[model samples]
Structures are given as structure tokens and as C-alpha cells.
Target chain A: MRRRTEPPGLTLAERKRQLVRDELGDAALRLLARQGFEETTVDQLAAAAGVSRRTFFRYFASKEDVVISFIGLVGEQIVAEVEARPAGEPPAVAIREAVKAVTVEDFTENREKSVALIRHTLQIPALRARFAERQDLLRDDIAEALARRQDLPEPTPRLHFAAGLGLLAFAGALKHWAEVDGHADPAAVLDAAFTEAGKAFAL
Target chain B: MRRRTEPPGLTLAERKRQLVRDELGDAALRLLARQGFEETTVDQLAAAAGVSRRTFFRYFASKEDVVISFIGLVGEQIVAEVEARPAGEPPAVAIREAVKAVTVEDFTENREKSVALIRHTLQIPALRARFAERQDLLRDDIAEALARRQDLPEPTPRLHFAAGLGLLAFAGALKHWAEVDGHADPAAVLDAAFTEAGKAFAL
Candidate 1:
């Protein structure tokens, strides 16, 4: 923790590295949006980011790795959002808002590129399987988030089913958004899914 | 349709073939339970089933095919059960019974082998992917079942989410059952999951 209180030079260096990573991610997303994942190369991504090929390698092992990393980051943000919700909030409502936050924060800027990246990843069966596994882990994270704020805890079947239901809605929302070619608003889709899910699961 | 009206000889032949297939399947499950998927081979399965290698091939092209076929049958039975529920019944109740019927009808006999089969299949990553895809399709089937029973038709987001939540409980119950080494009563697990899910999703 003390490392965060760095000298001015180290702070600047860290900030610069983060900026380069973000730029490379943006450049890669632009290429993937225009050209398919296959047509985009790491060299082009490096050049577009104004970084050397070696620097690109330092950040992401491969072109696919960047997309995976982006997905991982989005999932983490959702979990964090869920955890950060008001402790008195209802679990279902908190989960819905947490997922809503993901679309707003992650896709508000360069929305088309984000959609294109989602479509690109959905096209790959292996990546989809990996995504499914992460969703499974995300269920655990959501449960932990809920458990932290409530009496539920790990191994609680109630938590498992609730988390599972949350992810099911999430996956459904994503599938619908991608099916519409991502032209429709994803946040709206998520809103629809969660609203429907709320009514569906209730008496 | 006239095939059913065939003479006694033809009818006997068809019945004999089904019994043989069932026997072969049981034998394969027994072997899988005793040894494992990798350790067991086509030849060994055939020998265990007391059938020739060619007969085993005729029944299943591969050892893996048999497992897939079994899983496919279970999934179909679950869908059928859901579809067969009383039209006036609540969607959640119907889904609960449909999944309960799976453990009852499939596990009443040879309970150990059934557990072993589930564990064996879950151990394989490729099979898990196939299972997830099939679960996606099952969601559609559940929606269709609900639509047929209720006034809601196609494109109903409520029906879609209801189906998704049902599958979520079903999957959680299965995962929990598998985690317990399958010695526990699976029907009880499903009961607990649905109950918890109901309480969790409610306002």
C-alpha cells in the first residue's frame, strides 16, 4: 500500500503506462470493429497505439488476450458495483443496478466498438466457453457480494441460486443484444431482462 | 405408420433391439462407474456388454457418443416433463416438478451408475460446453412449454427470463448434487434449490 505514495517521477511513469495500455486497447478495439478479429494483427494494433510490438506483448500476450482481458475487467467491475451497493438494498435490485452500471460505464463511450468487440468474442466457441466459466465464477463473486452485506455466505444454497439467476439474466441480456447485431441499446436490453426476471421469479 | 402394424416377427425384432440397446447402455454405465472414461475403451465396453465390437459400433459409434446420447435423453425427458405438466399449473411449480421427475425417473434404478455418469461427464470440459449449449436450447424449450400453457407467446421476455431462472435453479441443484459426490438425494437438492430460489427472487 505504501508503494502508492510514490515520488512524482514514479507516479508519472505509472500514469504513462496506464495511458499506453488504454490507448492500445482503444486502437485494438477500433481495428476489431472495422476488420474482423482475424484480419486484425498485433503489429497493426501496436502501430495504431503508437507503441512498439514488444510493448504490445508486454501488455497482452495476443490479440485475443486483449479482448479476454477487457471482458475480465468488465466482469470485475460488475462484481465491484454489486459489492458497493447500499447494504440495505434488496439483492435482486442491487444485482440489476450493478449490471446496469456495467453497460453505462463501459459502453457509454465508443459504444459501437464495444458492441463490435462483444460480437467478435461471441463468434468464437472457445472464447464463449471461457466466458461461460467466468460467468460461473462471477456468480460466486455476486454471492460473496450479497453475503458480505447480508447473512448469506459461501456454500449457502440460497446464495447459489440467487447468483445463478442473476447470471442467467445477464447472459440472456447479452445474447439478445448480440443477436440484434448489437445495434439496439444493451443497457435497455439488460433493463428489460432484469425487469422480466424480477417478475418471472416472483409469485 | 404401417410399420407398427407389421407382423409379429417384425414387432419382436424391434422390441429385441430396444432391449439390447438398453442392456448395452447399462453395461457401459456400469463400466464407466467402475473404471473411468479414459481407462475404458470401445472394445472393453463391447466385451462388458457381451456384444461383438461391430454390435457396439452399431449401437454407438464411440464411447463418448454413448455418454452424449445418455445426456441428450435426460435433457429431452426433462423438457418433455415440463411440457407434460398440467396447463393450469403455475410455471414455477411445473418447472420444479419437471426437474424433479428427472432425478426420479432417471435415478430410481442404478442410482450409483447415474451419479457416476454425471460426474464423468462434468469432468470433461468439452462435454461441459456441449451441456451449456444444450442448456441454452432447453431455455427455449421451457419458454415454448410456458407459452403453450399460458397466453404468452413468442418474444415474451417474461417467459424467457422465467425459463432462464428455472434453468438456473436446475443447474445449481445439479452442481450442488455433484459436489456432494452424488450420495445425497438429488430430488431433495432440487427441492431445496427451488425453494431457496423462490424465496430469493421474491420481494
Candidate 2:
């Protein structure tokens, strides 16, 4: 078996910066867990991570941003995946595949941490608001990808709306799976939602 | 044929209060149209309506509240209508009927104002955030109502998620209808969305 390691070819500056950001994120989450979100300060986080306040600012704008920074990467991956789907695939299928690819494998890896993050987000009203805004941005990105496909019609707002709702269904399913005791796998829950949504449409 | 007049049982105090709120809302919208949303002030609205600043606060907490007050009323009506649906109807059917009833009649009478409100809400960032929050509240309300129906199994969160998405589809259809140049009735638009959603679900 081969051990996966960071590529050896990176510039020193780029590698150091990535390492610093990772350290800062780990410190921030640890602080968030030990001391509540409201109690944790940027200065404290900086000290905990062995980084200066200036370095902390360079990495993250604030404590809230530290928690949500991963979403941007997730959003980019989803857009790429959706765009990469076969040209004539249906909009819903493209969206479902994108959501599944991003969430199932990604969520499974950090199931406990992700659930804790969700609980933390729900408890903090400000984080909750920002999280919802992030979701909206992701929805628009998905919608744009769907709209740009040559297979879709010119007035694609309705299709965009439907696809966005489908995404929400998957999100809701994941939330349920995380919160409920002995719940099914998040991916299975989302798959059921998609299937149920398809059945409801048929009615 | 008889000419309809004000009902004899209507109270003078109730009518006066309503008249004042209407005057304030009208003045607020007119000012918002002339100046931008940020430029408008509660005092200016009060002066325009010939009411004291105290009276303005009594009616609305802030300028943003004025734009969203109507939506609050509509949301309450939607929840109530959904809860009132016959016992035998499925959760989705009840939700669809409730949303249809609330939007169909209101849109007919207030088409122009509704469009203006939608456009204004979209343009203002604060208003847009509030709009999203309100939608979240509406989703919860619909989900709760669906949960209460005994015909369904103890409502899982996925059911609520599906219902919430259905409501969003209805809302998205209405919004698109308002945007188009010669779109037909909003009710028809909602019906089409419901039909499409049904088809999506294979319901």
C-alpha cells in the first residue's frame, strides 16, 4: 500500500501558507469546541494556533468565516461536477449526481465533526444566517450551471428553481440524518428524498 | 343589484387604525420610490403621513418592517389555510391547496403592488435577507402542519423537507409569473408549478 503525501514540488511560500491556514482552522475549531463561539476571540485563536493576529487576519476575516470557509471549496466542486456531466443529461440527474458526489463521500469522512459543526451553527444565530446565505450562493451557482447547458430551454428559471429545490431536499435529508438517532446513512436518506420527490411529481 | 357599503358592525377604532397604517405604508412606498431605501427615514415617513414619530413606531418598528409587514400577513394566512384542509387530503395536496388559495386571490387584487414589492425586496440586500428568513419561517410552519396530520406516519423531517421544497416551487412560479411581460394569472402559474413538481415526484 502506498502512503499519500503532499506533492513534493510546491513552492515554499505556497506550502507554508497552506500549512498556516490549516493550523489556524484546527485551532479555531478546537477553541470553538472548548469555549463557545461567542466566547472565542480572534486574539485567543491566534495565540492558540501559534500565529500572530496579523497572520490570523490574512487567513480568515473573522471567527465565523473560519467555520464556513470549506463551503466555498465544496461549492466549486459541485459546479465543476455538474458542468462535467454528459451534455444531454436531465437537469435533476445532473444536480443529484453533483450533490451526491460532494456530500456522500465528503460527509461520511467527517460525520461526527460535521454534525458538531451543524449543531454549533444552529446554536449561533449569526452563523446560521451566514450558513443560509452560503447555501443561497451555492444554489445560484448550481442554477447557473444548469441554465448554461445547451440542452435546456431559454426560459430556464423554472428549471433552475426545481433543481435548487432538489438540492434543498438533499440538504434537509442530511440534516435529518445527522440529528436523528440511529438514522440511515445521509446518502441513502437523500436518495430516498430524490425518489420520493420524483414520485410526488408523478402524482 | 345592491351597492355594497361598509359593514354596520365594523368598529370605528379598528377602521381608524387600519386607515392610519395604510396611510403610513403608502407614504413609505412613495418615499422609497423617490429616494432609495437607505435614504428614507421613519421621521420622513411619519411627516409624509401626518403622523407623529411615536405613532410610526407604534405601527412599525423600522422602515424595513413596512416592506415586510404584508408578507407576514400572507404567511399567517398560508399556514392557517394549510391547517384547515380536510383530514383525508395528503400533506402535499393540503399544502398546495393552501398556498394556491392564499396567492390566487391576493395576487388578483394586488398584482401591481405585489410586483413592485418583489422587485424592491430583491434590490435591497437587507430586505432580501429578511425575505430569506421569512421563507425559512414559512417552511417550518408548513412542516409543522404536515407533521400534525395523523394520516401520515409520525412526520419525519424528510417529509417536512419535501413539503418545504414544494412550497418554494409554488413561490418561485409566482415570482417568475410576476417578472414576465404578459404572463397569465399567478394562480395558473402556481398550478403549473404544482403540476410540474408532481411530475418531478411522479406523484
How does candidate 1 score on lDDT?
0.75
Q: What tens-digit string does per-residue lDDT give for candidate 1 at B1-203?
A: 43657676577768888889898988888887688777888888999989998999998856677776776777787778887888788778888898888766566566766666677676765556456655666778888877876655553777777777788788777777777777778788888887778777555
DockQ metric for all predictions? 0.36, 0.21
The residue pairs found clashing in candidate 1 are: none
Cand. 2 TM to true fold: 0.78
Measured by TM-score, how close is model 1 to the native structure? Answer: 0.71
Q: Model 1, residue A200: what's the lDDT?
A: 81
Candidate 2 chain B: minimum summed lDDT over ten consecutive residues — where?
B194-203
Q: For residue B199, give model 2's deviation from the true position in Å.
A: 3.0
User: Each candidate's TM vs. the true structure?
Assistant: 0.71, 0.78
The digit string of per-residue lDDT tens for model 2 on B1-203 reads 33345477556776888999999999998888789788877889899999998999999976788898888888888888877888677666787788888888777787777788877876687776666666766777777666666455456655565566676676677567767722477777877776666544221
> Of the candidates shown, which would achieve the greatest TM-score relative to the real structure?
2
The CA lDDT at A97 in model 1 is: 85
